[model samples]
Target: MMLLDSIGSVFSVIALKPIIMLMFFVIFLASIGKSIGVRRMYVNMLVRIFEYGRQNIESVRKLQYSNLNSSDVDEVALTTKELSTDSIDQSSNSAKINNVTKLNGVVTQMVNGDTNNGNSVISRVESLILLPGVENCPSKNRDSNQQDEIETLEFNLSNCLDYVKSGMEAIIEDEVTSRFEAEELKNWNLLTRTNRHYEFISLRLTVIWVIGFFIRYVILMPCRVFICFVGVVNCVVGFAIVGLIPNKKLRIMANDYVFKHTFRIFCRSLSAVIRFHSREYKPKNCGFCVANHTTPIDVAILSTDHSYSLIGQRHGGFLGILQRALARASPHIWFERAEAKDRMAVARRLKEHVSDPTNPPILIFPEGTCINNTSVMQFKKGSFEVGGVIYPVAIKYDARFGDAFWNSSRFSMLQYLYMMMTSWAIVCDVWYLPPMTRNEDESAIDFANRVKSVIAKQGGLVDLVWDGQLKRMKPKKEWKEKQQEEFTKRLKGE
Candidate 1:
């Protein structure tokens, strides 16, 4: 009895030690609750700080540009309304217009002989040309009314000197303001970085956060990697075996089963939590399913339950091999855009496949290329020409965990797969919209656009006017520079 009592006492002490330590830790955390309630408290504080900073900067900008006179009050009011309600783009446009109007008023007074300081039209033109950044300003003709007024005043033609002067003044003003605004933005970004650095340093004092970070990255990451590896192996082996099946009908059925299960396993490996939503109506025997192109993994997400014949472009490397196998297993279509004959054949194949009830619904991403998932680009007309009930599948990924956007130009297929596999679960929101039929008077392009609009609306994504091919074209210099500036700002934590 004595020996048993001693053993029980030792175990009790051991358990009590952990309890005591836990109590002490909880008390210590509570002591700091006034300054840091939780991890989320820091996030809220950071957001508040950034929001305050943005407001301050905007106020300063408005102060710098606030030069409205009694006569210009209406214009300023209009501009103020635009700035308040419209986007940053519209705000900048209003600013430019306001400046131009101001400069134009000054030019018009001088040109109308209201304030003749002995400066001739030619002298004014020369002065404008000599102004910094004005030499490159492209010349534009004035309105007919302005031209008539200049002629009535007997002012020399000389390519509408007054209009040129007004344009030059506007350009000069814009250039100066733009430079100042860029510098201000840089300062703001620097401030943001300094604040974030200080905040990070302060947060490091918390013991629990450091321990949590260590566990998440050091222990959890490796486990996730192992799980993903197992999933990949499972998929590869299953798919390979499916590829070797001799019978076409058996191969199709086997491939569908493998693909569905493999995709679910793969998603589980990444910890991706998928939620599927449909409206009151679901697509049945629709013959075709059109979806917004977000990433190549879209296929795995969309085809998890349903069997679909995929229509895609010719790919290269291992993906190309997989593509070929998939095409063979099912009645899928692959087209090379470079070959006109191939496109024609694909068009015919799509029509025939839709007509065949034995074949599954043909799934096509009419966008042709993956976008950033923020917007849906224009759809190609080829799929719409099939003239059948079409199901538009709108896919929106919650990128809070990790960005699912596959930037094809920047990353290869392997890189994208590795990215999705390594990240915190990919969360997807899939919407199966009502089946749509082409209108009697609608052209193929019109029908495509109509369906695209419905998907965009349902997905709560912006509908971009440009086609997918245009998105791949070289961007404008101004746009590239703007992107670089934004990247720099992000790096600085602005």
Candidate 2:
């Protein structure tokens, strides 16, 4: 009976009680208060945080504090004030280098979200992310599988466009300024917004949390105590139910359930003012799945439709730590793009995950990275090699969702969501085309182009499609498949 009562207390605490948590918070604040001038600093900090994203994001609701905080955001309207950086001042030196330099090496660092000192920032800013195989990448060749020597394409500009633009004003100095504006305009396809939305939502979340805590501690705790009293009485009368059998899987499942339900309801409720058609993909099983990286939310957008194991790039610090937890509980694989040694190992690990039965299909962004969602970039080979039956999909958000593009710059997720509501409705047509198989002779680029064609045809926006030799080969995949089957039959002497 005593044990049952004690166990009951824990359940009571979890359900509605908040006294324990409140007491903890009080003690925490009291301790912090003792620091010299801490209270003043803290209050000011909180107020400034609230003021940060006042007008930036469309709807600020979720309280993701760890990723970004209030003062960290600039809520003032994003002005036409040109993005000032130290690198542009140094670009004169950058342009002088006429020899072939590996730009991706620099861009990859930026893509990995790592800033290389202050100088490389300008050179590393990549507005466009090529699909995996469209360009010759070292990541694939690391594997034992032999790859034919291939050439990669440069930026889609005819000349240098790096120039100084002052206050929404074009300060053109020859061809350099034209290229610079074009570069900005190109990436502008992926709408850019200030991070004020995050600030707004963080403040909201702080408010909700405080109210919920107070209600739990003041009202719910007393109620739970009464329930525990009942549990005590029942113990003498019958077999007292004791502690719950700790089930990690069940806990993980419950967390995911609440997490998802909360996200949906949150989005739907918030969507009352915002304009996104928010939903999840309902999957019958868990396994590896891949999509073209149009926007970074391709995973979240798809996951909304179905709950599946997600594979994504790794982040360090708090973001990475949470990811590590999620990855451990669910199916997730991380690839270090910078690790020359571990790159192949990463691919192998992905292959293993794809082969797992319990894992919701492993997902990959064949484009490897993202650009403006106008067209699909060259597909990476990773998906085609392991994901034999390539599920080609093209996600097209409304033009209003323009600011929703994922790029190298740091974008607050909440701010982007808010933009969707005010500026546009988020909509994407996820076409489940027939799966594909690999061939012995065909290159990865060929497969990517074939899939790209399928996506482009469905979206009705291939007019400016970048055609390469891979797409030029008529019936390339079909021809390759026929030859493969014939070769197999001949080998079997059938």
Candidate 3:
């Protein structure tokens, strides 16, 4: 009663924050109560911690345990040893470091869990074996066992860690040496590297574009507009005098010469957009190449990168310039949509093109249809019909460009072209799969499946089933299921 009365008197003397001070005392007491509850939580929490520690320690033990068991403490001392005298590769070293980092997480979890597990296990065991405050430190350990056991364990662990660290460093150095072997001069990975580097340099290009735009509007456009007006007047005057002079042939020649020169300049400029690359593959060649069908920009990407003659619909565009230029290039085997049902005629035409020895390799985007680049659409089997060898190519836009939101919408060709020209920094992958020879008995769908499998494996590029049409990037399980379903349907047709 006297102690309680004294505490109450002290509380009354306190000022504005009395409730806050009282709450703090309550929380402190609650924490003490929770500590009492920890024994109850130990079974589950300790199990998790133990699992983590076991995983971390397993790597160390497997790699270095023998060294530790030998009790060669000097051999176990990792710090005393130096890395390999042979110069190691930086990249391989980095990769090993990454692997080491993965181990770090396992180690941290191991240590944390081990500590927690140890505390929990010790607490539980102590309760069963000895009373906390008065328990005698096993009479033997009080003299030497405890100290020696701890030192031994520490030494074992240090050597184990050192061995793992050294092994990892060696792995990294070896990997760097392998990747940059200068012997294979064929820059097969040149495409991927260019895409990565292009991303870095794009900001500079954008700045130039922004500045060039201002310059174009301020200086070039007005002059071009005036030039167009003058050219129109001259043409009008020539047209007015045409009939009496009977000079139609001269006018035709003049027009032809002007357009020819203009075309050469345009092709040169487009080629410059992508640095010089030659992607000429023969249809008879034993390789496969796949493509994404979006806007005609997809065609330009192929032409600029690989120079493969494209096989597609005979569609005309502005000035008929693209159509004319591409037509002159061999392997531009075009067929109208109406010709699909006329299988014999279409196959015959394709066969002729493929038979030509002089013609460059034919490239096809079997999608036969364009979709929002957000997903890969189901492929059309037209290209599969001419099958000799197939190489699956996947071109996904890297994130440097806001890809998810940026494909051209609906039928807006102009906007689509503009968007592509400005922001389509793409990562193009060309995976050359071993050729699949035509089986006289194999149906087209089977061939398509073989092609699809080749592509899906390229980078797990698969169709997603959204609302109705198959959308791309559907989860792998679902994509595989859809593929199975498609296979069944095709078999039924066969």
**Could you give the candidate ranking by TM-score, starting with the highest?**
1, 2, 3
Best by TM-score: 1
Cα lDDT listed for each candidate: 0.61, 0.42, 0.41
- lDDT by residue (152-204, candidate 3, tens digit) is 44224342333354345435442112211111211111122113232222344
Question: Which candidate number would show the highest lDDT if scored against the true structure?
Answer: 1
Residues 97-195, candidate 1, lDDT per residue (tens digit)? 777577656545433323322112222333322222122221224345653554455323453444456567746442212211111111121122112
TM-score of 3: 0.38
**Clash totals in order:** 0, 32, 10
TM-score for each predicted model, relative to the true structure? 0.55, 0.42, 0.38
Output the better candidate (1/3) by lDDT: 1
User: In candidate 1, which residue ranges exceed 4 Å CA deviation?
Assistant: 1-201, 204-233, 239-252, 279-286, 474-494
Predictions ranked by lDDT, top down?
A: 1, 2, 3
Better of 1 and 3 by TM-score: 1
Q: Per-residue lDDT for 23-97 in model 2, tens only?
A: 334333322322234334543443453334232222321222223433323321111112233444445434423
Backbone steric clashes in candidate 1, count = 0
